[model samples]
Every structure is written in structure tokens, then in C-alpha cells.
Target chain A: MATWLEGLIALVLIIGGVFLLIGSIGLVRLPDLYTRLHGPTKATTLGMAGLLLASSVVSSITQGSISVHEWLITLFLLITAPVSANMIAKTAMHHDLTPWKRTKGQELVDPASRQAPPSDHHSVKDGKLP
Target chain B: MLTWAVIIVAILICIALFLNLWRLVQGPSLQDRILALDTMYINSIALIILYGIHMGTGLYFEAALLIAMLGFVSTSALCKYLLRGDLIE
Candidate 1:
């Protein structure tokens, strides 16, 4: 392989590695379940994509044949990661997993505790209040 | 040069895998454990791909693909179980 191609592969590998490291660190260091979900779903998926991209490039350049397996894996990950994250988020919501104390939108998580409208105008407009 | 880069990246990924394991071991809740497990398999796929590159062979690609498919399915199934308390329902 040419020096430039080698550099490109190295660059991709390092970038993916850094993102993977960051994702796992976030998983370990984040304070709450909701926050922890951010790490693997987003950062790790991106890192995997980078790694697969590098693999595809390596296969193509070194072996002189188009390799679609990496592409297939990358596509699968990209398509499924968000779905799984959404499912996990739903599970957390179903279990009422608390977000980090500093996290906003607490009221959104539980509507009963949400503060009432200052004047009930909104409720009146919805025609629920009598 | 490529070898050195791959080595450094492999070490980094290994550390990442360890972190994932730490979370899996100590996660406070079931959802956290599931999330940690999800991350672990994905990181493993990255490691396997790295190994494949190091060996300059396409043989490992299938294994990586298999891991990816199984990881996604297992994650979804786990989440479904948590949400509905039943895998099929």
C-alpha cells in the first residue's frame, strides 16, 4: 500500500478509536440511565462506522477487490442503532428511570407533577376545566 | 506506521471494552446493564474488524457481521422484555 493510503487508514483507525474510548468513558462516568444512553447509541455507533469504513478501504486497496461486507455491517449499524436506542429509552421510560438530578424536563417525564398553568387559561381553552 | 497505528487503536479499544465491562458489572439498574451490554458487543465488533485488518484477510468480516446482527437482535429483545415483561407481547 502507498504511504498516503496507509496514512488514511491510520487516521480512520485513530479517529474511530478515540470515539469508541469517549463513548465507553461516557457510559462509565455519566450519572443516570437516561444520560448513559447517549454514549453507546451515538458515539459508539459513529465509531463503529468509522472502523468499518477503514476496513472497507483496507480491503479494497490491499486486496484489489470491492468489499461490501463492511458496508453491509455499517449500514446495518446505522439503521438499527437508533431503533435500539429508542427501544431502550422506551424501556427506561416504562420503568420510570430517573434522569440525572441536574437534568431538565422532569415534568415531561411525569405529567402529574407538572406545574399547573398560572391562570388555567390553557386548560380552559382545551375545554377540560369547568 | 500502519502497524503502530493499529496497535495504539487496539489498545484504546481494549480500554473501551474494559470500561464497558465496568459499567456492566456495576450498573445501578437493568436498563443500564442492557445499555452496557449493547456497547460491549459493538466494541467487540470494532475489535474484530481491527484484527481482520491486521491480518489482511476477509475471513473475519463474516464474524463481525454475525456479531452485529446478534447484538442488535439481543438488544432489542432485551429492551422489549423490559418494556412489556414479555418478549413476544
Candidate 2:
């Protein structure tokens, strides 16, 4: 392997590792469920993307062919991470889980927890159901 | 040189997994625990990919892909169950 290739892999790997660590730390230290949700859904997903990119690069060069599996994983993750996070957020709202005390936009959360959409149209209008 | 990078990243991901476990154990709410679990699986995917790179093999690709798919499914299912109190309804 060339020195530049080694450097590229190292750079990507270290950055991905750092982001992964940051996401986990945020999950542990964040004060509220809503706050904690931001960590993994965004940072960790990005971190995984970085790792997958590095893997694809390494595999493609080593195997002398394009690697499709890593790209598939990355695509699936990008599509699904948000969906899962949204579902979890909806779950939190349904349970009326409290947000951090200093969290802004307090009024919106109150009614969202109390409001039960009666129909598909209204649920879509409510902007809370997906 | 690539080996050293992979080793460093693997250690970092291991630390991340441990932190996620800590949160999973001590999370104050149901969703918090779920979030921790979700993060845990994502980190595991990273670890697996790093290991594949370290070994210079594509053999682990399927395993990583499987984990990614299953992790998302499980997380969404858990959230849905919590929201509606029913899995099939």
C-alpha cells in the first residue's frame, strides 16, 4: 500500500472513531431523553458512514473491484436511522417524557403530549406521526 | 501503518461501546435505554468494519450488513411497541 493510502485510511478511521466516542459520551452525559436522542442518530450515523467509506475504499483497492456491500449498508443506515429516531421521539412524546429544564420551546411539547390525532389526515397535519 | 490506525480506532470504538453499555444500564427512562441500545449496535458495526479492514478481508461485510439491518428493525419495532402498546396492531 502507498503511504497516501495508509494516511487516508488512518485519517478516516481516526475521525470516525472520534465521532463514535462523542456520540456515546453524549448519550451518557446529556440531561434529557430528547437531548440524548441527537447523539446517536446524527453523530453515530455519520461516524458509521465514515467507517463504511473507509472500508469500501480499502476493499475496492485490495480486491481490484468495486465493493457494493458497504455502500448498501451506508445507504440503509442513512435511510433508517432517522426513521428509528423519529419513532423513538414519538414514543417519548407519547409518554410525556420530560425535557431538560432549560430547553426552549416548552409550549409545543405540552400540547403534543396531550394531543391525540383522531385520523390519518389530522395526524399528518399534527406533524407528529410518520 | 494501517494496522496501527485500525488498532487505535478499535480501541476507541471499544470505549464507546462501554459507555453505551453504561447508559443502557443506568438510563433513567425507557427511551433512554433504547437509545443506548441503538448506539451500542451502531458502534458494533463500526468495530466490525474496522476489524475487516485490519484483516484485509471482505468476509465480514455480510456480518456488518446484517447487523445494520437488524439493528434498525429492532429499534423501530421497540419504539412502535412502546408508542402503541401493540406490535401487530
Candidate 3:
């Protein structure tokens, strides 16, 4: 019974690891900034959740109880990953970064694309960039 | 069985980590490097959690949580700086 459960946990871990690995590969290989942002934000978040799930299971089995803290991390990650991705995407836009040629036409869909508004220019005027 | 699985996953995650490092090093743009750093820290959390599972120790959980918190803060700060041209008004 113990070994069976361990095998199950291992299966979860393997899937999580593969997700994480693919996320990293995307981070390295994706053509442009905006497109690359999609990879780590989604896949890695799911991967982390899987690993945390495995941890929760292992704790329950070995320590004879469920651990709530891994779940906390899981929730924290789920909330923050998309938020971080949003911030990063906005920042990239503020920098006027371009998309890959293959993935062009973002300017048509996203009015907020590359061009900073007049108000954004005012902020830059008031603040000194490091 | 569990031990072998953990080792194999760890090895694969390490390869992932190195790929992240390569992106961090060779990334063409500042945004790309920042993204690389973000992904790397997240990978670290996965690695730590896997280690804790293998050892059956809850201690590493705290470390993973801390990394997650700090990583988010750092990424946000960088974004702020990039977006506003200044971190603080």
C-alpha cells in the first residue's frame, strides 16, 4: 500500500517536472518578449501546483497528517503568477519592446501597445531613471 | 521507487535551471533577462519542494515560501522601475 501511494506521488512529481522543464525551454526559445511571457507564467504555475500537491500528499502519508503550508504556497503562486506576468507585460510595453515578426499585429489588438500615452510621458519627465 | 523518481526529476529540473541560466546570460533584451530571472526562481521553488518531498522533511517548505514571496517582490520592483522610469516618486 505504501509503495503504491509512493508511486502515485512519483507520477505527479514527474508531470510537474516536465511542465517546469517545458516552461524553462519556452523562456529560452520563444521568439519575442510578449510571446515568451505566456510560457513561464502559465505552465510553470501549473507545474508548481503539481509539485506542491505531491508535497501535500507525502506529508500526509509520512507525517500522518496533511500540511496546510504547501497549499498556502500553491495559492500564493496561483494568485501572483498572473499578476507578475501582467506587470512584466506592461513594463515591456512601456519600454516599447517589439513582438516577433511571426507574431505581429499586436498593435491592432492592443491599443496599449508600445506607444506610451501623454500621461506616461509626464511621469518620465518628473522622475529620473536609474 | 520514490527515491529514483525524485533523483530523475531533480536531474531534469537541473537541466531546466541551466536553460534558464543560459537565457539569463544570453537574453537579448532587459525584459528577457528579467523574465529569465523570474522563471529561474520559480524553478528553484519547484526544486526545493521536490527535495523536501524526497526527504520527507517540512523544513524546506518555509524556505520555498520565502523564495516565492521575495521573488514576487523583486519582479514587481523591477517592473515598477521599468514602467515608471523610477521606483519611487
Candidate 4:
């Protein structure tokens, strides 16, 4: 007889694997960099979180002691994924990489605030704070 | 049943890892390759965790944590290098 604990762990693991697959598919299928950025950052992050949770469940059930350490991995990933995605996107924009026509890429660049776009930052810099 | 699920999930993640590998090798831009590498490491962590589960031990957690740290730092450095043409100013 399959235990409920085993069934739950299996379900979570399968779901996590599916999401990882979807994220990779998105990476390959998406045409533009900005759109492509969404693949690894969002879907893959969640997928990893799912897998970590499943691991925690399995460990706690079998060893009769909760493994709280795995949660640290999940927490670290959740915090970093979005930040890394943001930094990578900013770098892409600095390179003047074009976005898809359907994408309103300019909205990502706030005109009213922040320093000049990375491309112009060099030439526009007077070594003065404005 | 749990073992079967682990096998299936591992296979799926392996397929995903290969896809990320393809992108890393056939990248049209540096950013794509970096992103692919980042995703690849993340998938590997999943694989490691699955291995730990299969072994019925949490010992692999340390290795996964190290991979996570190294992957993030590398991705950030690569992206920074791309943006500024230097890793550190």
C-alpha cells in the first residue's frame, strides 16, 4: 500500500519536474531576450522551490526529524532569482539589445528617474551628481 | 511508488538540463548563454536533491548549497562583466 506521505512527495516532485521542463521549453521557444528572461527566473525558480519542499517532506518522514536546512536553500533562491533576473535584464538593455515588437520594452526603462541607460552613461557622465 | 516518481522526475529534469545545455552552446548572445548556464546549475541542484532523497539521506544538502552560491556569484559576475566590460571597477 502506498502511504499518503509517499504519494504527496511524489506529486510535488512530479509537479516540480514539469515546471522545470516548461521553463526550459520557454527558454528555447521565446524569441526575444526580455521575454526569454521570464523563463528561468519565474518558472524555474518555482520549480526548484517545489523540489526543495518535497525533499524536506521526504527527509522529515523517513528520519523522523524535520530537515529545516533545505528551507534555507529555497529562501535563498526565492530572494536571489528575481534580483539576478533584474540585473541580467539591465545588462541586456545596456547592450541595446532590441525587444520584440509586441513588448513595450521602453516601459521597463523609467525616464523620470535613475541614471542614464548604460550605453549613454559613459558619454553623459561629467563626474557630477545630478 | 515514490521511487517510480523519483525516477520519472529525474528523467524530466535531465531532459530539461539538456535543453539548457543546447541554449548554452548555441547562444545567439552572451546573455542567453549566461542565462542558460544559470538554469543548468539550478536543474543540477534539483538532481542532487533527488539523489539525496533516493539515498534516504540529507547529506547532499551541503553540496547543493555550495552549487547555489557559486552559480549565483558566477551569473552575477558574468552579467556585470557584460554590462561594464569589466568584472570589477
State what share of the real interface contacts each candidate retains. 0.95, 0.94, 0.88, 0.88
Please give the distance, in angstroms, between residue A6's alpha carbon in candidate 4 and its true position after superposition.
0.9
lDDT of 1 by residue, B15-55 (tens): 99999999989998998899999999999999999999999
| Candidate with the greatest DockQ versus the true structure | 2
Candidate 3: docking tier = medium
Docking class of 2: high
**Model 1 ranges with Cα > 4 A deviation:** A111-130
lDDT of 1 at B1: 81
User: In terms of DockQ, which candidate is stronger, 1 or 4?
Assistant: 4
What residue pairs clash in candidate 4, if any at all? none
TM-scores for every predicted model: 0.89, 0.91, 0.89, 0.89
Runs of candidate 2 with Cα error greater than 4 angstroms are A116-130
Candidate 4 wrong stretches, greater than 4 Å: A107-130
Per-model tally of clashing residue pairs? 0, 0, 0, 0
The candidates' interface RMSDs, in order, read: 0.7, 0.7, 0.7, 0.6
Candidates arranged by DockQ, highest first = 2, 4, 1, 3
Among these predictions, the greatest lDDT belongs to 4
Candidate DockQ scores, in order: 0.86, 0.90, 0.77, 0.87
| Worst-scoring 10-residue span by lDDT in model 3 chain A | A114-123
